[model samples]
Target: MAYLFLFGAIVAEVIGAISTRFSEGFTRVLPTVVAVVGVVGAYFLLSRALRAGMGIGVAYAIWAALGVCAVALVGVLFLGESLTGVQAAGVALVIGGVACLELGGQH
Candidate 1:
C-alpha cells in the first residue's frame, strides 16, 4: 500500500538522520555508509509510495514532518541532545501543519 511505503520511507529517513549524526562529518566509515544507504532507500521507498497513488504534497509533507520529529526525538533520547521549549512548540506546529495538509486533502 501507499501508506506502507510512506511509512518505510519515514523510517528509512529517520535511520539516515541518526546515522548521519554518528557519521562524525563522514569521517566514520560504517555510519557514513549506513547514512548514505538509508537515505537512498528512503527516496526509493518514497517514490514507490508516490507511484502507488499518494499525492506528492501529502506524502512529502508527512515524510518531512515525521522524519524531523523522529530525528529530534532520537537526538534527545540517544544522542544526549536537549529540546528547548521553543523547539518543542515548533515540533508541535509541524505536526499540526501536517494534520492540516491531510485534512485539506480529504475535501
Candidate 2:
C-alpha cells in the first residue's frame, strides 16, 4: 500500500535525522554512512509512495511534519539536546497541522 511506503519513508527520514546527530558533521565514518543511507533511502521510498498514488500535498506534509517531531524527540532523549517548552509546543503544532491536513480530506 502507498501508506505503507509512506510509513517506511517516514521511518527512514527519522533514522536519518537522528543519525545526523551521531554523524559529527560527517567526520565520523560509520554514523556518517548510516546517515547518508537513511536519508537517501527515505527519498527513494517517498518517491515510490508518490508514484503509487498518495496525494502529494497530504503525504509530503505528513512525512515532513512527523519527521521533524520524531527527530526532535530523539535529540532530547538520546543526544543530549535541550528541548525548551516552546520547542515542545512547536512540535505539537506541527503534528496538529499534519493531522488537519490528513483529516481535512474527509470533508
Q: Pick the candidate with the highest TM-score.
A: 1
lDDT of 1: 0.97
Alpha-carbon RMSD, each predicted model: 0.6, 1.2
**1-107: candidate 2 lDDT, tens digit per residue:** 88899999999999888888878999998889888999999999999999999899998999899889888888889878999999999999999999998899875
Worst 10 residues of 2 by lDDT: 15-24
Q: List, residue by residue over 1-107, the lDDT tens digit for candidate 1.
A: 99999999999999998999889999999999999999999999999999999999999999999999999999999889999999999999999999999999996
**Candidate 1 global Cα RMSD:** 0.6
Q: Model 2: runs farther than 4 Å from truth? A: none
